[model samples]
Target: MVGVPTAIAILAFEPPHGATALLALLLLAAAAAGFREPTPLWYIERGWAVLLAGGFAVSTALAPTRPILDRSLLTVAIAGATVAAMGAVRPELLVGLDWQVADQFERTLARYDFGWLGGPPAEAAVRQFAALWQALYPAMLVLASVSALAVTVYLLGRVRGEESALPPLGRFRFSEHLVWVLAAGLVLVALPVGAWADRAGGNIVTVMGGLYVLRGTAVLVWLGASVISSGWIIAAWTLAALVLYPVTMGATLVVGVSDTWLDLRSRLGVAGNKE
Candidate 1:
């Protein structure tokens, strides 16, 4: 079941379609080989994974013109965010969102008759947007993908009998060594290197920094929950996110990176608590 989605992701990522397809086929075959007496839950999960993969393909097809990697990441980001949101609000709605998004995009694009607007200014704006997208979309995709997977695993555990399949969000953290990866990217970007090096560095920093931000949020949540009610925590987070978005995100990112060394969660005194 896991191989199914893993294979789908691999096939979507790179060039050399023939090679990727062959690799995916081999993975699927191996997964099939390991299949034993299947349970109803197994079929349900398999079907869900297939549906999600199909939706990703459809969404990718519907995406606006972009580099292959950008399009793939955008599709994954959109699908993952949609899935996560649906999971939080109404898990049952998860199945239809991808199709709906693709349909909506198709309809909107069909209605768009204008080729270009504002000439040079518009072109410049678009170039800027592309640069920003290249820098940030990797992070968005990483966060969204993890959220979607966590939701899936949580739901699976709820439906079937198992120990906790997902850990408490408050306890989330990545390996500390990942900070070095982010450092290397930042160094590359700062150095008087070529454009290719800067682009690669920007992507690496964006993705790894996003992970650290998540880790920082986990520490904050754990500490906040220790002293405050959930209602207050939610209220504070909402206010900070909506009214001071830049500040909030920056603080989280900084805190997250600092926590890599400080171990803030442990120092804060509720590090051992699961909830």
Candidate 2:
């Protein structure tokens, strides 16, 4: 919610290609989440995600031309404050997932060194791309902060057993280990962005802020999926797509199907029972 709105607002002021990319990604996410399993709750939650994503995309498409710094700073502030507050309350929410993703991304970067794939790796290319990314990183951080804050509040409400204030669905009750895995994955992807931004002399706070936004957005998308599908398996697959794209999506689907089969076997007493 925070990210979509903030992105829209920022793009409205100073349109950028990156904003379009973010908006497109969000739209794809909403469409993926909207797949049906024949439930009222599913329709409602998926509808919300789709609506929000569309709103953001349309806003970005029509965004006006303006100075990047001026447009981004305001958006970043709004997003950062929200994410920070969320994190302070629910520190465990995103940090673990962020770490995991950051680790995986680092390993991938190390192995392929795709820098060479794009012609001879040049310092100038890396520097130019890094600079552009650095400039945009702050906005990402701010949006992440908002997402973290929202998740914390949601989790805290769940912990206190305050179901009334939550969404129509109850608090997410997935395994803690799973949450940790997701958090670690998020951190893994963010590490490179953070490093690049820092080396480019981007503000550290802004960099951290963007990292959190990226983390928080991932969490929000996951939560949204969980709400829509009423099953962690679906949500997990959706999140894998959001974070790791095609590769993670494929892996998650395979794992989810296996887990589902095991669950069915256990439920039918076929796995651990004597006939």
lDDT of each: 0.62, 0.42
TM-score of 1: 0.54
Give per-residue CA lDDT, model 1, range 67-172, as digits (tens): 2333434545565565577678986564454344345445644563435676667656665765566445445545555455445334334434468756677877
Q: What are the runs in model 2 whose C-alpha is more than 4 Å off?
A: 1-71, 113-275
Question: What does candidate 2's lDDT look like per residue over 86-182, in tens digits?
Answer: 6789997446434544454455445645465575466456556645554554345444433533443343344345775333321111222333433
Model 1: lDDT to the true structure: 0.62
Off by over 4 Å in 1: 1-123, 135-143, 162-164, 230-234, 272-275
Clash numbers, per candidate: 0, 34
